[model samples]
Target: MSISSMFSNKTSRRGFIKFCSYIASALALPASLVPKIAAALERKPRLPVIWYSFQSCSGCTESLSRAHAPTLEDLIFNYLSLDFHDVLQAASGEAAEQACEQSMREHHGRYVLVVEGSIPLGAKGAYSVCNGLSSLEQLSKAAKGAAAIVAIGSCASFGGLARAAPDPTGARSVAELMQDGQIMKKPLVNLPGCPPLPVVISATLAHFIVFGKLPELDGENRPLAFYGNTIHARCSRLSFFLHGQFAESFDDEGARKGWCLFKLGCKGPSTHNACASCKWNGGVSFPIDSGHPCIGCSEPGFWDSKGFYQPIRGNVPLHS
Candidate 1:
């Protein structure tokens, strides 16, 4: 299923080029570069990837498995040389660990290390363990040889739920580890979400493979192309907000009529993510469109929020 495997077939070439074009559009690249991306992917060696998990629910990995725009098969079979993924790979126990170690040694300073959860420094990094090594120890070993690192969810990016107030695990993010000299600094990108949109992950990796570098990042280390706009600006309900129409309850007339959920504690106004545009469940609907208010899961410390149903701070009484 590699690009080389598809070279002899005409239909696959069309499909491959189409996949490349879709990826280009998703990454906000011009139509002109689709051929370049296709050519690069067709010839460039498959990039080595190691998907590691720590204090996570495995939701980010789950999200990527469901990626549709470029399709998970397109990414796995045609683009990346995935070396290690605990949940997906067939190897288990000691053998799996050895396989991961071998990939690190073999692809030293070349593999992309993708981490999905936060590192717990509590109890001397004993809160979360994998195999016989603590999360920190394993991360340090893998990170030393990584060309770049991708922190895949709110957990790895900002300590997430594990690092909520009165946290027992002393969970810390990848950035914090680098800052504290716990893990060596490498090119890093943080795609912060409860679980980042699947396309975002695929697009980021595609950008790296095409350009031979990471995408431009914001101050918070998110790719600006994906996280630049607040969900509110692109929300389908924006006109309702502007028109002063609000849904006070999930079952209210306004709600049924597609009015804005801002009054019902939608955090879309302040949240930065591609959900409003990119959507979920394969572009079907996001929370706001499904009669649920956003909980701002993409932002840091969201788990510590007082309540998902509580109104945002500095609320203006629209009809007071």
Candidate 2:
């Protein structure tokens, strides 16, 4: 299909520049570099992204699909040549698998491989199989030819909740497998969360397209631009946190009054992400905004090891 088929007529150099201006200003970048950002956005080719599924609920796909102002149509059609995504593609069964194989072959050493779920490494890896091929085998083979691999959710990035508790299928993360140096040799970027913010995905794609490389990453390989500051750094309720006023229960007056949820097991103080600032569902709301505690889903071992509903002592000092 053509680019025009996916994006609105307004998707032009000026519109892209206006977008960069908004994003740069949001990230506190200098206005003088707006033209540079625009030029970078204009020149880069829309990357080919091959999205894979394993043992997952497809929440990451769902989250990213909600990108607004420029919806997934814009994302897949304008910014990315999403050659094969199991969830969004029209084909099914053999037809779908073959299409993915063909795209991988056609874009060999050129496409971005986005793994959305964890690989089940138990019972001969039989837990999740597609087209009679084990997910592990398919992933390993796909990784071998990808230019770069992005683990797009907590599942693929850190094994997520599926790997929690007994970990019945021995779920493992993309980084764990890649770290052993036996699979794909491409650089990896992890965007961990139950569902990462859409802008985080957009920014990563933009960085690759503009800079021709991944953004500066944290020790865990997450983009520093999005994950550098704690959620507490940008949370709207931080003022309440500083005053030591916290909600003691989900439906109590404190909560009703929009007091901080730190006392009710919010992990925002230690969680690093742009959830508060970028929000979700088209910048409408986030976990905290919706009256839910920040579960720290982006951090490692968040599912199984996250502490109980109580304020953590000796917590980092609240921002003024």
Candidate 3:
């Protein structure tokens, strides 16, 4: 994609500026930075992204694809040069392997390495393989020259379902691999979600492409701009929660009256994310909005939590 392609055609000069403003807000950047964002998008070439999946369900990639049309998410995705993706690429076997190798060689130390799933460390790394190489080998080889690493979904970021309980494959998150020296260290960011919100995913990627560096991250390496507040802090039912009106059951009267789902095991009070604001399916609704409790899919131990319907105590904070 050309430098100006993001603003060309139907994306008028005004629309372009509006987009910059939107991204600036989404990233929690100052209003004054909008101009810089606009300039950066116009001056920089399309960024290269190499997508590698391990033990995954491919829900993360599918989430990105669900971005509403004509939105910044769609445009940013369109602007990126997706060099390699197992699910999206047409080539397979040697052709696919060669293409990936060639892209790594050509864009060494510059391309973004986007990992989509958790790594299975057991069974000689046989849990997940592509192009005849195990996930570990592929990650080790690829990390040698990547400018940065972005792990999407709870699987890649925090081991999700793959690492729960028995952990049959010795599943581990990208951060864990880094901590254990199983992979090379690099500027890394984790977008943890069962499948992260589409806007959050796109905004983080756009921030990197625009600023030439990762955004301000929290302790978990999540973009603080998006994960800064607990879901309960910004939830629409917060008033209900504060008023002690909670739905004890999915079909209860409180539920019919749009009451809080805290009694129904909402983890919103402890989980931090932009789900309450950015929402899902283009900002229409999230799980709680549908009268269900928040399962806290974005948090590290969400999958292993006591139970999705088990109420978490009071509105205490677990994230700082």
* Candidate closest to the true structure, highest lDDT: 1
Number of the candidate with higher TM-score, 2 or 3? 3
Candidate 2 per-residue lDDT, tens place, 36-140, comes to: 766765566678889998989999998888876456776666678887888898988888878888988988988889999999989988999987888888899
Give the per-residue lDDT digits (tens) of candidate 3, residues 2-41: 5456445456778777777888988899999999987887
Full-model lDDT for every candidate: 0.88, 0.82, 0.85
Q: Give the runs in model 3 whose Cα sits over 4 Å from its true position.
A: 7-9, 69-78, 314-320
For candidate 2, give the lDDT.
0.82
TM-score for each of the candidates: 0.95, 0.91, 0.95
Candidate 2 Cα errors over 4 Å, as ranges:
1-14, 23-30, 306-308
Comparing 1 and 2 by TM-score, which wins?
Answer: 1
How many steric clashes between backbone atoms does each model show? 0, 0, 0
lDDT-superior candidate, 1 or 2: 1
The TM-score measured for candidate 2 stands at: 0.91
